[model samples]
Target: MRRRFCRPPRLDLPSLFPEGSGEALPAVHKVASLGTPRRVLALLFPRLPVERLRHPGPLAIWAAQGSRRIVLSLSPEAEAAGLEPGQALADAQAILPDIILVPEDPAADVALLDRLALWALRFTPLVGVVGANGLLLDITGVEHLFGGEAALREAVLDRLARMGLSAVAAVAGHAGTALALVRTGWNGLVPTGEEEAAVAPLPLAALNLEPTLMGVLHGLGLRDIGSVAAQPRPGLVRRFGPALARALDEALGRAARPITPIRPPPDMAAAHDFADPVVTREGIEAALDALLVDLCRALREAGRGARRMLLRAHRVDGDVQEIAIGTGLASRDPKHITRLFHEKLERLEPDCGFERIVLEAPRTDPLTGVQEGLGTTGRTERREELAQLLDRLAQRVPVWRLAPRASHWPERAMARVSAFGTVEVPDGWAPRPRPVRLLRRPPILQVMAQVPDGPPFRLRLGRIWHRVLRAEEAERIEPEWWRDTPDRLPRDYYQVELDSGARLWVCRAGPMGPDARWVLHGHLP
Candidate 1:
């Protein structure tokens, strides 16, 4: 009987932004940000254009509008030559004759921002894109995971710098506060309720206002957020509009906003924390046993099975060891899944004692019921045992694949697949008396025969000759004519005993014609 496995559901992840957005993305207005523990972090990428340059040397990137070209970013050498952002291209060229200028690519920038946001998920699950040049993360209750807020901040900044990004990171109780403070060019944790004072000195342009609105604010001498907030609420609303007031209120922690993370949260997860770290394979297996129990229970209750799952081992010293497993079919069988994990764990390197182990099944699918019979159940159980053994051994050694197909040619009789996938033998209907071990390719040998189609009397293979004590009748196996690479001959296979009592399976490539070739194909032990 053939075995059946379940398949998982599909998912399609989207890109960052649609094309044609040349300038900075407008500040995102939150719709309904989660009201979790307010720890929001804003990560600013100040030298994005300069860092994204394909080559190392000094370079400047600019944005062009017809005949008008303005500098978007400048390298250190260009800066030394008095070329700054917002300078006209004509003036910049006159100042620095040797600088290379690249055009701005909004689509590429958005894609890079999307990838960076995905990378930032290593720190927090609540990462959101901030405008075009920044990312917002809600570290919240997870700060202690990496040794509190300060350590996590340092780790984030250090990693960003190592990735060649010049970034500014600020954490606060509100997303808006973190957004404003990161632009203030400081890297520290601002305590809750200090958002107003923290951002009081930043220029009003930091509000990211429309150019006309910024000019209006400048005309009214409202040069900073502190001065703008000090004005009468109605006057600011009536003159500058509600967007400014809302932005100011959000900046000051007066309004709540929702941050949309790049991807949706994981669907199912099971984790365990140990008081004492685990160091041995036996301990890891025991923990995995308990975790699989919990995970299988959850999947059973939901009527779903995991198609892909990741096991993460968080060591006490801040290093994480992870192993992932995937199946073409969904499975919620704890014993089967645990066996797979055990097979993989043999090669997993753990640098330190692991204090926590978490298993996340990010993808799952429905598993409908299957009927079982007494005789069928017995056969299925045996097949399952055979499958488990094959799976375990395949990890250590390469195994040939034999699928459900039939052919007369010994070498091309069955399908072969990779060692990692399922091992299947074609129907248990192979012809009797065939050699148990067949060579990959039959080797031609010199043979002496008494008659045209008779068995071999003597075989010469390289420097050794084997005298046949007994020879059996030739078994001719024919080839199929419909194959793409059709075999034009029939094989005359024979079983013979040599003078030294060794048994051999030899064949003639075709009928004993004038040009027939004798080949040694297998040995019987």
Candidate 2:
């Protein structure tokens, strides 16, 4: 039996930052001096779902879990009325019967989180999402842009407050230490090399341990981070395994974990903040030109060219419109890149005018200076011009090139691939001549032939009968054994010339018998 499979759907998360120091890491280091201690910020939204609704009265969000409904989040008023998350809904209502209840929307909450992460780009480009309702940012050398570390923390909280969100932010030398401090309602900066002292007094829950492991720790009377750290490493590992010790080490900055940002930082970037919001296309075009000049100059200085460029327009109403373009070849020409983005400028909607515009190239390749022939247009100049033309046409339509694939099956010998990507052809492999055009789906044909595997003498197409004048020797093609099934069979192909001098490509599927099938596979020119 032949088995069929369906292809999986693709995940669309272009904003997801790649793990480790992709191409963006080197640029981040260039902004600050080397050997600088990492400064991380953990921003938490305790009542994210409730705050999203903006309900002034007491409210609680609940969801169905198993056979009963439980509270998931609570507003400040609801919290003051003796309600809490994970509490039974029935019990919560029994305490405050007038409290408003709304169903939980995890998807909406997540979407809002992603939008907030995008908004955070104004503060620093390195923004990462922490679990469900929190964010992590790396502000190692970016604090000076907003005065200092303390001012930056306040600025983040103050801006989120203006947007009607309840945010608690904490900064520390390590990511884990910052997150632990934020959960405890501590909103201050922990100096470098003091992560151990900062997280020592926090509760065991701050470590975010598994419930089972937490239970064992509580049973053993280890209830605080300080107590857990006081124990010897080997003894703790023997009793509670390595996870306990590892978590402690991470919290104390003895170990480190890199933050996976919501968007990959760019290789080179430039931004312009408008004193007054600009609403006209002319203003936007002028700003974009200035930005391109700065970005291209940076690229030239680095001896590199951008392959992918992204433009972000931050509107006054907090919405961001992004336009992206890719080139078939690396380029740093401001005029050329501007032309590519010209067609896409209308896609941005200036709801209340754009407050800031940023341009960055996330993907780049090393490109040395190219010298063209002295007087006339040279091959090198023509090649670069061709790539630019292809890039423009591709913006409006799909463009690709066909490459040869390594397969014996006629239908699987060719593939569509990227125009700029490298193509590999198998070595020392040659195929027999085929038709100029192969049918996408071969149709069955009625034929009359000699007995015991002889070539067909005549074949019928619709109501016309064509007598075969000559038949070439059969070329047998076997199915690829790895993909073979019980129903598949070998094929014998022949190029037969008819009386009218028309050559047809036909194939016989299966062995010689009354059940044998004949298919007109292609038309020969």
Candidate 3:
């Protein structure tokens, strides 16, 4: 017999975050897609520190980390004065005594990066935040949608400039390679399969490795990526370890570095800032008409309809008044949506005066096409009109929806749902002659039955006694065999009319057993 051996499973170690070793980093999503891998575009904003500043001039701004006061980031003017990032505060002041220094705000920098990432979704959905001041996008096949890669890059840069942001973006075959190119000041599109060659000339520092690794690579005379790639893989792994080797492979497009795109941002928004504040309702209504026109135009172009809308009024005294409205379906009709707002405009109170007004659509869906004849009396048109009326009424009072549900018990068959939520059970599950109203809990009643299995001749409701003048044969309801419960075995429901011209729904717990209980469950109109 031949000897048999079993191999042990290999463990894949998690990558460590360079910025902070032990802390949990933001989630990175991977796309497992078919066909050729996606091409990534990395966007970097080197001026995040200066750009987010309220008074960013030719000043030097240094952010603090723990006790170290160093040059966090600087303006181009500060850089021309020989003041650079990571320089000691005392030393930076000694070099440029006139440098206007401010503390760094890492949170604001990250927030602006997030906002810009959301703004970048007009290009492609596959965009991710790289570190604190960068965004990675998987352009893939989406370049031609905006003409071409070069045009797309320029368009993005221009849009950011319009948004008061300065960004440099680079496109490459791989995310790692593209990120490297962006950090090294490489702008424009790098053709597919040329990522290695394009990034080979960049210095090792451009890879953004830890100081110790850079020092070791420098000592070994591996100053550029080309030199590092020439070394034997086994030796590099044995010396610098897996992170360095893996990075090199990723930059060369030999490894997978998938990007997790953020949630897409809402695009429907219109705002007007006023030089003079307006406090009257008439002024606000006039402003609303203008906002609706602008907002509806964008919605039409996108072929999307707003399901939920928000109106924000900024008061002169820093108070913001907001109102929200929802529709039964996605609709971009200006007249209809304006009418809904008109119903509730009286509730809007501008304490001092409104300085700015912004309208936003937070929830939107694809606009559906509906064709109608000249006269709008068609069945579909009537139902649509009814839905609209319900939507209008919903702004004032709650609209309750009732539908049949799946249940063995007669009283449990019907369920109530929200007006805009899911529809009810199928027609086959619905029973006939349902009572107008049903009680939440059935109350037991004392009854005198003249005959067995017959409707009660007289029943007591609370403190009153009523005699049944007319009655019908009891409908027997039984529990489903698969869903048997000892207590909910069977019920005999009867429709009975009292002498006082009132109808009632009563149920016997069992088939007229000696100890059977009678309960008043519902009332009929």
Name the lDDT of candidate 3: 0.72
Better of 1 and 3 by TM-score: 3
- Candidate 3 lDDT over 295-351, as tens digits, reads 776676667788887776766544456788888878777788888898677777887
* Candidate 1 segments whose C-alpha is farther than 4 A from its true place: 1-36, 269-331, 334-359, 363-525
Q: Report, for every candidate in turn, its global Cα lDDT versus the true structure.
A: 0.71, 0.81, 0.72
| Candidate 3 residue spans exceeding 4 A from truth | 1-40, 54-57, 121-127, 137-148, 158-165, 231-242, 265-326, 330-371, 374-382, 390-417, 423-525
Query: For model 1, how does the per-residue alpha-carbon lDDT over 1-525 read when each residue is reduced to its tens digit?
Result: 011111111111211110111223222111122454567878988778787664565688999877899999887778887888899988988888888989898888887788778666555445789788899876665565466678778877876676667788888888788888777677898887788898778787667778899888899898999999999999879877899999898888888667887755445655555667788898888878877777777777778878777777766554566787765456787887886787788755566687667666778889656332323476756765665566556546665665545666777665666533665556664656767768888788889887869998998877898899999898877767777356577778889999988888888977676688888899976
Using TM-score as the measure, name the better of candidate 1 and candidate 2.
Answer: 2
Worst 10 residues of 2 by lDDT: 1-10
lDDT of 3 at 506: 88
TM-score order of candidates, top first:
2, 3, 1
Worst 10 residues of 1 by lDDT: 1-10
